[model samples]
Target: MELARWTLETDPAWNEPRIAAQIKLLILDALGVAIAARDAESSVRVGELIDELGGNPRCTVIGRKDKTSLLSAILMNGTQVRALDFNDVQYFIKEGKLSVAGHCSDNMPVVLACAEYLGAPGSRTMEAIAMAYEMFGRLRTLMPFVSPWDGTSVSGLIAAAIYGRLAGFDLVTQANALAMGAMRCSTPSIVRWGKLSEVKNLANALIAQSAVQTAMLAGRGVTGPLEVLNDRGGLHQVFDPALDFERLWAPVSEPPFIMTSNIKPYACIGTAQAAVEAALNLHPRVKDRLGEITRIVVTMADLPMIRKQQAEIHRQYPRSREAADHSFTFLPAVAMAEGALGDHQYRDRRWEHEDIVRLIELTQMEVSEDLARRAPGAMPARIAVTLADGTVLTEECLFDSGHSFPDRGLSPDAVISKFTAITAPFIPQGRSQRIRAAVENFETTEIASLMALLQ
Candidate 1:
């Protein structure tokens, strides 16, 4: 309801240099992921869709030379950003409880798309990104219910706002854009459940495209329910009854929301990060004992373990790459067998490897109340390997690398390394370095140049 008013009026403390730096890192991290996934199946599929939906050329798709309509560009670029599932994630802290909001990078494509279309500078892009992150973070804290749709829906609204801002829409027009964006985009939770598909990665992209379309309509004088967020039977009533309107309308923070987010070091679901780390930690100890491993027990929080068990029938024989990547049993087993979990591990029928399948067949997941209690702050997990000699080795991962843990948070150099490695295949060494340098000095670089480097 008041989200529109707040979006128009709120003066987030973006003048701070520290916050500026964090925003830059977030954008760079997202771009790295997108560029790296240029050749991924999901990205290629979305590119084909863009071709099918031919429109006026306006924006460039990352890692591709083709330019398409604004909406098409957003869809293609957004899908690439999430194709590998290695983008950054937002961790919302409320009432001493921690909850994952969504991927902050989902908002980057919309911002970058709009900026490139308008020839806006990197500073403008950063400001738009900060706005999106602030809105997404605050909205997550306000929502009372947890649904997979929250990320895409919230991202749609933020994307609309960014598009409106770039188009020089007045407060009223921008608010209308938000209203329309919110009213139209309703993603389903099924995208993440059961046997996953390419749709899983494209959900956010669709919402973003819808947001841009709605914003374009609003900019041209179209109107929507102004109180879509809080009106009777509106978003609040339809999605979450426990919505915290007070906090949602409250003032913005000093450090900003991007600072609280975490980058993923591995290319898998966020929940599986800790488990994979735990499994990898135990990999060295059992490297020579694979033939002797009779059982591998993974204990994690109740909810995560339950979600993993939902696919018990397919854990050892995943029919799709998406399915294998999201499987708790499969991912840990892959970590143990390959010593790493990345794009390569999920390809070339690696999920069907004899050792991995054996490990998956031997693996068991159990709900640990202790681990559940430690969740939201620490995604705790324990992996125990029982060898043929009756010897058991156990290792626990409390905070995954690249997470926002006090000591484990990824440094700038580490982030750069990750970006470089992921995009190395698609982008040449010199070009990738130039892109990184531009992001490092993003405030002065124009978004057009940055987008060019990405292509």
Candidate 2:
């Protein structure tokens, strides 16, 4: 009731010109990344699973000419968004440590599927997306879960909020649905730990998939512990013990979190973006002297929270495609040696090159305490190359260019260029233009028509 009380009280959307512009860009970015990954191994495997487990076909899956049940469609589209590890990510600062609390756009598939099913217009979808962004930002900041407990633990609840608003669930029903979704979808964080498997991309998507049914049950008079929100044996028990419901539910007067999220210029983990920039910045400089280099040093933020699994020695030496993307050593080495970072660098087992492996061997990942304090706000990385002649050429990137800060974020034109570049190979110029127009003017466009463009 309290959540609904505030939900009904605050404006669902901050529909000014800039707000509309930013939301549309973020949506376009998510959709582009998803479309690029339509043929990923994760997508194919999940498609097979969808076929084996049959449901009514009524929803569209991005980049494919097929229909699926709402849940399967969400799973397929959500997995595509994350399959390449290149989706939009929102990081949070807690006690001066930058921690990734999962992606807000992971639930975009839920909103899109819901919009198609409800035959909702793009205006209504934008409103629901704004609500989902608001709730995710607050929970991610106030009482978010990090490593050891997957961020999807928080995302599932926000997915329910979007579902509730779009489906016209009453205050109590929506709130109860949030609780039910939370109770059911706290997946283990191990999926991202150590050597990552294909399942890593499917973790949050799995939560979104299950949320479709659980949220609907609440809408259909399925009762859950409403008090589970703050009372014992619920959020307080499973998530943060000292939960601050008031702060978490407080209305956000600042810009929506979508404005601060990073759209991921590189196809690697969020933390590795700075490393890519750092490596790329020094790539041209080191191109001629790469062989003369004796060592490559990457200065990174000292992240104690997530240091256990990723910082381990074996993690630095990637053994699989998933591991290569998350590998700090592999990323910088490949970028420095190849002068680029993207899905292409990882394909064909290019990281296995003896020269790249030699670079990885020469690479060392170091952390700076000062850098740690500035993280999540500014992801800083510095690359220092030590040549055999004792010459050092250094480059430092204070933040990834793709970050959505007002002062120096990625420009609208650049974002559009990125979308066009990545999805150009798969999508024709005409269809790409049509989708861009629809999303840019999304507040007035029809969801069904836009989805048809994607299909």
Candidate 3:
């Protein structure tokens, strides 16, 4: 019953039907995000690989043309889903800070891949998604006493559950899969601390890989330690210093839907949220005044954590993607000089423009207690542009366009358009349309039939 103590069975008020609906909606939303960001090289790499490895029709892998082996398909497609860190996120109330998000896409790819492997119907895909989300959410909610660890703690277990369900494993086998998956995948938090290596993008990929491996091992009747969650040397003791199991279980036991998920408009960390919005808003007005600014002050809610405040890594001049992604010092400075920030802005040599360097020289980010006291998902960044002639313009951004725009809260059409816009340049028009159509209407098609086209 330890598995029961850790998942859907633990929640007495659990609604199987509602959980299913939530999962279906989550997948749809996730696909929309993935499609929008598909053109990024990381995403393209995965998609192109899937397309080249055509196999028996089995599952719907987004942004690719062919059905591949389930394991390969999920690994590639799921990695694309998070290649840019621009997916939906849901947080648990227990820690108030420790949250879980698109790593669930790790579960989605594996689950859908299994659907292909079995030639299962959409109904089966839907059920697998629901169970995966519920089980994942439950594990995330249940473990608070462990930290210094990352969300992979929750992600791996959820992924394993998805893999097990798709592979026709029973409750015990599913539990074992989760145990082994977690054991293999858990890690320290430094992976995301400094620069924006492919590490953030690969976090979910690693967990998904572990999930698939665990499921395969379980299928062969392999058994792992069952006390993975409850053992004295288990996750909580090893990972989190301040553990609280009761509060973690309370929300899941009562089974309240933690649907307050936030979607990213910019592919960056939580700390950069407000600054990105502020720059996007002020860019239009300040474009003509690029050389006139005396000082650019970005007032954030809190002193950004260790990595974000690194002057040398980002402010001194970011040399790599990881540094650029986490550079609180660099993003606003670049936004000030260019009037906009896009995927190209991250890669282009334009980031080193003299004007941007000057802006970086002039820009300073300060912490405000009032701002920090505000709630999550409500990012508040204040930009005060002081001109050479002593004139000053100030703007505050509460939410970025894609995430907070009234009609733009991660809309499906918008996501589809984003996907097409980014990927069309790299893929053939016909292939792009085919992939988009399949992603948009996945429920109606056999996953394998759709996957076959990808190849």
Candidate 4:
């Protein structure tokens, strides 16, 4: 298969110093979210389940004292990383359309697990993650938003490739690994929309587990359709028939998708980040007159406005933390009223508060063609607050602060600040320092050493 040939010939490595540092930064950001989620409701429930399914305890559950089998640890760790929708995200915008999107860090736990299993060095783990992100971006160019296919559909394939490489699989076995896993990793996009659930947290984790198993099975001579990507009724036929299958084999981009992936500075989904930023920009000007505010108008990119602003019961409602992140309703309302957005806003069903609800009700969302043209890249948002005195205060955010493309990305110090902020409740100052240091000097550190700090 072409994928096998590419995997074998086009070797992966984090040789560039800048890319290496960025990879380490991504690791720190991922761990920040995963560690901070140690007490999240989903993490707690899943932690209980992981404890029940006790196995060899071969892998760390990450940011927790618990240990479980490799696969279980992947599930638990992945769930925790996504529990807060605070992990890093990668978006593929082809021809001004959002083709596919998801958290790049979703592949981190599985790679770390494989590295732990093989006693691999931190260098190998970094290269493996870089490869996974490259694959995610390449594969995403083919899986557009027009289909029901979710971003996790690429997770299993990426996970399989990582395992095959770490385990020293031959080219044939490696291709089979990807194909075998891809055939089984068809995830729907619904998990992330409309009253999101804990299932959203588990989607990528479960897909990674299956993908790892498929790769392992391939190592044992188990076979699957090698032509899964090109068969008469394959992925294109199943997802979007018009999908450009050739994008799957296109050369991986330089600097890779991991570098472009966003490091979220807020505790909300990517689509809402810019809107929240805009609202916060308008807060100081309108905070004192919040009660006098007649209506808050938020204009954003097309797709999200339609998907996140239509109706409350449909999905826009802040029914839960998951749904709240996707809601333009709760995000801007809180940001404007409080002048900040973070973990605390999601507590106590804050959206249910009378003032917040009234603010939410008074909020109106509209689509902007100019802004829509910039989406999946800049994610521009404009917030116009109308007052009782017939005055309109407006602010616009061209890009979310977390965005990392075309320069002006979050600085390492900014990333560190975010890490310290989110993880303060769970990780002590000394321990956080140690973790940060270990990640900074990741090339020489062992995979086990890094995981140890997380535990």
Candidate 5:
């Protein structure tokens, strides 16, 4: 749990041009996703809650001119970023096992809030974000738990460290922040399973709020057991006993893990990215034979397929946007019908479209043992459309476009396009362009100036 000693020691990779560009792209992507989701039902509810629990204005909320408490700002901003589930992801081979460490941008709101509050430069914010990403990546690899909600816990740890560092806390205070944050970090698996709800999206926000409070407490001389991770009946005993401590404290490589993280191009769950791609690929062939198609079979890795099956409510009828986006059958069906899967596809009206619903009913999600075995490295999926004329057209997507797989990763221009497309709807075109330019030159800009433009 001595995270300060391990993270404060800077590595040269933190200053590498490639790593800096990757971090800027990730931050811009996160901001764009948050801005696009500013009006989302969940985000609106959270914003109202913040207004009701009004505190001294300390930091600016993204896409809003008003300011609020540091904790409230982090909660609202983090919720907005995750509202659409279109943020980035970090996957790695840890202890010889492939794992996803959740979305990297989950910790960015905390970093930005802290930096803006301190009047720090954007360069400093970027450095803090890089550190948080490294910490999250390392800890997630060490503790590969079953629940994806555990990523919220990892975000809490990273938030505490970032806030503590920005506040000029000592090593002991930083350690206490980690211990307190970890002690308070625990989420049930049900948040993401079965019928998804607003809680599924708010989980990270709740953790980010708690992390800011815990870090503040630590800065004010609050104390927590430093041996939180290694002690008996501590983090290891309470959750993820299989944690690989050696790997958790291991030295990182030159470019760091953020460079290897993925920026999602779709507005759905990460597991469904490849399936969506497959559906898009198959759309062209099935466009003319929509009425003639008898059934559509989707083959994916076992974990995702099982997740879709377990959400019985979504399978039968996805009544809410949250459930619809998480549904494997419904997502691909939307992609097949519309040739795309974006925020608009999850609207209540769109869900009622008979053709898409019929496509959902006709869809069959199957488990592919080969694909399941190749998971974490490749989220592969195959889609086959069987027409009434007995013609079966099929296509497979080994990796989603945004996935960081060798030459298959999304291009810089593609990332910028995604940012502009999502962000332009909420803000004016000129403002969107300014946001992009600020992020491009984030190294020289002040965090406050960049944040002011967000309003």
Candidate 6:
């Protein structure tokens, strides 16, 4: 669809304080929200990564006793935050939808590190984040993401945006860095083993690191193509021929333009968000009727046969974190088996339960147009439980937890509880509280202070 006339250049204005304030709130909220999840696997991975990369006690790695360099801390912490896919998500409500949970995390590490390393103020850090986040959305629209491109195409742009903002690059320099980064980083496609590995969670870190590297290069008088997006072999033409420049730029000049976002309730793939809710809703009712359940028919609208069918493989037998997120069958199966869905429940030996296996095999998935309409983030599902006696218990969830609907926002307390619960296992109660407090009070605090708390 064509978008109204709007371009970043046509309506560029510098509003440092308001935009900086906005970035600060988002940073704290995302950090706090991620810390509050209840994913042991995520906590453990984060903890280990922190210990592996030792640094000066200058930076605090939340949910850990060890401190690290600002860069390492952000990298380790950001990756861990998203490791379980339980971090906050930013997406659209209807018509157009794209996700930016990890990408923001990408900017967090880069921006925070830049702030601490250069002793930049909180406003600068915020500007870095806002710029990177904006670039992430814009570049994604104009490029192909996570395909066979081994190196990050958009990642470098995000990095450049973040770094350029902090290093005080003007629009011209920033544009050049963006263009050069795009040209240098573009490739055929990268293996999307993200569906099957922790490496997927690390995608943000890699992107962030690349962004920083590119920005540093630009700061040092390095130059790249200025017409990166509009050039002969520019990103727009080469990356995604279907890209709608008009639509992308329509609100390109508007304030408060960043509207797409979602906070996750479950630590699984975007597609599994609705399934978890459906399974959870069915749990209390199915408790006593577990044995009576002869067949479970799960109907998901919008998802393809592959996504729905792949779940059976992982549900029956999961291989890795990547597999777990993509599995439509396993999440609900484990939820039904363990009474709830959490990181451990999926990776725990309890997944070997015979009843769960039987349930997974017996559980069937079907697609509906209604489900497809919910694609990209809101994955809607309907679960019909057929008892041996012919009784059927059915539950459907189109608006699940952490979906970010204005009328259906997840409880803020629940958001905090989730962050504390996830980080508690790795961090002491006192440290967890401190981290929570820092995030809660992120606006007033200095960016350095925030970085100090994480180290």
Q: 1-455 in candidate 4: lDDT tens per residue?
A: 77765654444434666678778888899899999888888898889998888988788988767668888888888888888889987666665655336788988889888888878787777777777877787777676556577778888788898888888789889988988988877888788665677799889988998889899899999888887777776676444536666656566656467778888888887767788988888888978888999988888776642444445464455777777777888899999999988878888888888988898888887878788676546567888888889998999887776878633344787689999998999879999999999999988988788898888
The 0-to-1 C-alpha lDDT of every candidate, in the order given, reads: 0.77, 0.79, 0.60, 0.79, 0.78, 0.59
Comparing candidate 2 with candidate 5, which one achieves the higher TM-score? Answer: 2
Model 6, 298-403: lDDT tens digits are: 8876434334344454433556656765567677877765667666775655445687767766878776776656554465788888999998988888867655
- What is the clash tally of candidate 6? 28
Backbone atom clashes (below 3 Å) for every candidate: 0, 0, 21, 0, 0, 28
Order of all candidates by TM-score, from best down to worst? 2, 4, 5, 1, 3, 6
Clashing pairs in 2: none
Return whichever of 3 and 5 wins on TM-score. 5
Q: Point out where model 2 deviates above 4 Å.
A: 7-13, 142-147, 303-310, 370-376, 406-410
lDDT of 2 by residue, 1-455 (tens): 77755543446445656666777888998899999998888988998898898788889889878788988998999999999998887776665666775678888898999888878778778877777777787776655444356666676787777777788788888888877777766677778776678988888788877776778899899977777666776666345646566765675666566667678889888877887998998888888877898988888877755464346665688888998898888898888887988779977887788888899889887878777666547667888999998999888887777777843334687578779989998999999999999998898898888999998
Estimate candidate 6's RMSD in Å. 5.1
Per-residue lDDT of 1-455 in model 1, one digit per residue for the tens? 46666665535466466667777777878988998888899888878888888989888888777789888998899899999888987666544545556787887898898998878777666777777888888766655544555356677687888888777778789889998898766777667666667887888888888988999999899998887776776776334646556666577754467666778888987767888998888788877778999998988765533444434666446878888877778888888876888899977867777887898889887767777676555556788889999999998887777666432234677688788888888778999889888888998998878888877
List the candidates' TM-scores in order.
Answer: 0.92, 0.94, 0.79, 0.93, 0.92, 0.79
For 1-455, candidate 5 gives per-residue lDDT tens digits of: 44676655566667777778888888889999999999998899999999999998989899889899888999999999999989987666644545555787887888888888877777777778878888877777655554444556676677888888777677787888888887767666577666678887888888878977988999899998787777776777334646656655567764377777788889987777888998998888777778888988988765533444535765447877877877777888888878988888877656668887888788887777687686557667888989898999888887777776432334687689899888877899988888889999998988888888887
Off by over 4 Å in 1: 9-12, 93-97, 146-150, 237-242, 302-317, 369-376, 405-410
Question: Better model by TM-score, 1 or 6?
Answer: 1
Candidate 2 vs candidate 4: the TM-score winner is: 2
Name the candidate that leads on TM-score: 2
lDDT of 3 by residue, 21-78 (tens): 3444455546545554567677776666656776555555565554456666666777
